[model samples]
Target: MSKKRTGVFVCHCGTNIAATVDVAKVAKEMAGEDTVAFTKEYVYMCSEPGQESVVQAIKDNKLDSVVVTCCSPNLHEKTFRDNATRAGINNFTCEIANIREQCSWVHNDKAKGTEKAIKISRSVVRRVNRNQPLDAIAVNVTRRAMVIGGGVAGIQAALDIANAGVEVVLVEKQATIGGRMLQLSETFPTLDCSQCVLSPKMVEVKRHPKIKLMTYSEVQELTGSVGNFQVKALKKPTFVDPDKCKLCDECTAVCPVVVPNEYELNLTARRAIYIPYAQAIPASFTLDESVCLGLNPIVCGKCKDVCEADAINYDMRPETVTEDVGAIVVATGFDLYGQENMGELGGGKIEDVLDGLQFERLCSASGATKGHILRPSDHTEPKNVVFIQCVGSRDPAKHCAYCSKICCMYTAKHAQLYKHHVPDGRAYVFYIDIRSGGKGYEEFVQRTMEDNDTLYLRGRVSRLYRHNGKVRVLGTDTLSGQNVEIDADMVVLALAMVPSKGTTEIAKVLKIGRDKDGFLAEAHPKLKPVESVTAGIYLAGAAQAPKDIPETVAQAGAAAAKVIALLSQATLSRPPLIARVRRSHCTGCGMCVDACPFIAIRLENGKAVVNEALCEGCGSCSATCLRAAIDVKNVTQLQIYEMIEACLAV
Candidate 1:
């Protein structure tokens, strides 16, 4: 090979790195290398002038490769790449050495930090020397997007993406599109009716021509990569034709079978043939085959007989559908942490104790008690109600360690709602600390305390038990330094928000990573909050973390924006870095196939072949090949050896 020509540029990053590390000394050390054609220092390498200088040097010296020593590559790698491209050098020939975060911020000693920076630059230089010019391969993009989950987040994302003129497939696991948001009575801070606000979006999703709303459906399998994905969804049988059904209550009134309504948290009863609620999006009825008497042995067919529109069908079977899309949005939302195992909090055995969601149902106008705040054990109204915050949150010993972000604000809202309903009722909120970080949230909490006369105590509810027609709560007031006791008529626990059920399974299907707490992992917590590490797949709402309504909607919009951007491209450019297999060294052990997480490799004609379009350049197959038959296109064994040698060079 011809002699290598390298250019190095070090950035001060506006005193972020210059304050600790000597930028000029690091640049001078890099220039000492034999192949170093040019070296320079700048206050901000990402600035237009600095980039132009690097481009000018590459042209002036006819340099083949460049090294930029600056902040983390995550921040400015694209800027430097664009600079190299504009300067007539291949973008892949440029490498970035992070000195700001890895060297300066972490180290206190200036000399040591400078040494580390020089070493990092040397390794990058060696790596760039082995780099070859490569072109980004083009793949056709499908102008469509898929949204999982039918909650507020999913609805928002589907609407936004569809509004951008891209076709959207919204797959909902429930019979209705509205998820937990429909169950809520009134939203916090604004006090707007949850259904009133969410119902309009639900209708829009159902009516939009570009949006294909699939309720009672779930993603069974996901295959392919960004810009071209095949998703198979299983549509569960509702046993009632949505198109033919008139959504009248005639069938529900005549059905003899009665079951607990899950939407009401089992506090109310509904017929076996029923709709989720009055404002259900499709305006259709669903027959629960499990509870219906007509399905097995045919004891009764009253619902089918009573249907005026003749929409009942007991023989309906599940159907699977496949869709092609360019991008996917995961807005599966969250589930409240269960208190069944929390024995200290009465283990949900107390007659009048309930979770936040159940309380929300009770406060709703369509609830069992007609929106009256009555104790479940009796039909009478409760004179005293106790609200407990952080029941399953911030308690690493028993539950999750992270704070359930919405609990504090929602608990305050719950207190205010209760006060509004029962003028003579006394509401007591026990909390470790109030976290009202949203707009108007702190003032809303204050209104609950002062205007509504609700009592806020700083402490945790240690225990609860039924005593003489009242719930006895035992805990201490940390602020007052006093042991406290209360005999309450009802109790509500603000359970932690956990990633919804089957989220992990879905993540596995999509080949996406999740944090230890089971939430989908973002590419970067700050910069790439909405994008998942997996390309073309985005996250929104509580699926990523516990976020309130406004935040969830904003994230949904952000994910939609990413989808729109992806769909806008006429053809997507697949990374040039991908694995390659040598047919001559063929020992079709198939081990590499199992090791390939992206499923980009397969055995054909007794030799392994790679699907370059599907490959993510992860290099797992290359590492697993025992006979050295596989090698990643740009990253090879020789490059790694050269980098290590350069790092250890005296």
Candidate 2:
């Protein structure tokens, strides 16, 4: 047996630590430890020169392990580990002690802070002494990628990945590829027709040779790991065969079953046999099974009989398809905060008061009223329309505490569009604050107020109710310190943006995490915005957070680039820090299997086995093992005990 030599490098962090702790004394004390062969203090241990100094110290002192006591490992652990590898030592032998965030930053006394820093550094040094050098596990990759959701974000991600010479399977939960964007009339700032901008991309996705378009589909099960994932998806039957459905309107006219059209936000009626819109991708009709009489021939078969092309299939059933992919992008998009939750604002009971999406439908050219800006209650043009911003957002007590980022700009756009439709009509906007923080956004809001003569009231609406054939809005203007009331012909609520339906279910299926507000959680808020906690899966658009089209597209492109970079490699190098079972202590209680969140462990022949590819090194399995048979490599129980002893050593 050979003795281990450890080197300790303490960082001053340029007064971030030195201001509160004695860096020189801490380095001097660390040199007295048994395994520490060398110790030094630097102004910034993460700097290029500081890293060079560490490399030189390792080679000069014949050190086998290194510990860098500095900032969080998240920022510089990899840097120091790479430095160790460059100096001809195993990267696994390098460890980080977070002295700045955990010690100096939180402590006011210099003696206590320095003592805590020493304890933290000594704990990591002890752990590193016992660390065995390990190599990264390599796994072969599949060359395909799956993108969930067919919104703008998903479409852009799919196109980018496919353009990079990788195959893509694009899945949409709707009958058509276009998502919520297809239901919009026009976009903000530029005022371009939403469909006009998105239709071309929809066409491109359908015609791309490297892309497989799967509409009316949902991911049922996701298993496997990064570089090789197995996916089971359910392709829901639309009944109308897309290949044979000639976009003729005969079936819709003959159908007796009429349902509220979801595409129009239920502001209009649609036949059970109908297409989403005129320019729907795959351009076919979908038979609604939920509302239809029956799929059997004995039930009313009006749609099938009237179908001249015989596209309607009575025997259509959901088909499960399997796919193997290296990576996945989740761009499931968003849904507005339900208007039914707003009880004070009539809880969707007021006929003329509508939510933002419904207003978009009313303003759309292909909408129910043909872009007339008519009130839904009477089908007449509104004389005075009131737009309320931040309906269920930024209200911590009863609703979402976070600001819906797009609400302010969209509400301004709504007011501007209303003025465009009714030239002589009045538009009033009630808002907490105008948060037009994008390019040309502030100017657009200004233009709406100055040019269009829209009155902007700075306040929150207290109550809203229908009175005397008009929607009455009662609010207080905080800026003016006055009570304001308006009996408007129509009112629009700028509801908050929430994660689209099935976001939570999909997060559980993919083993990804979600934030407190229910959007998918990123690995890091700033550095790894698009990357999910799960290795192979990425996030974009409102599924991750509230964002507009340009931001969503940019994030989608970023996620695609990450996927491309990952799939471009012939094989992926995964961290070797995974669970390992000790066969001697075998009692295969299956407790570890039940506790493992990643499903990385399984009992094979009454012995617990670990799948290295699936394990995230979370240590949950190790914690659950009563016999202490299971442990994560490099983070074993012995190393943890030594580190804990070192920490408590006075």
Top candidate (TM-score): 2
Error of 1 at 327 (Å): 1.2
Local distance difference test, each candidate: 0.89, 0.92
TM-score, every prediction? 0.90, 0.93
Instruction: Please give, for residues 79-143, the per-residue lDDT of candidate 2 as tens digits.
Output: 99999999999999999999998999999999999999989988998898889999989999999
Weakest 10 consecutive residues of candidate 2 by summed lDDT: 502-511
Candidate 2 pairs with clashing backbones: none
Error of 1 at 446 (Å): 3.1
lDDT of 1 by residue, 519-624 (tens): 9999998989999988899999998999999999999999999999989999988878998888898699998899998888889988898988888788888788
TM-score of 1: 0.90
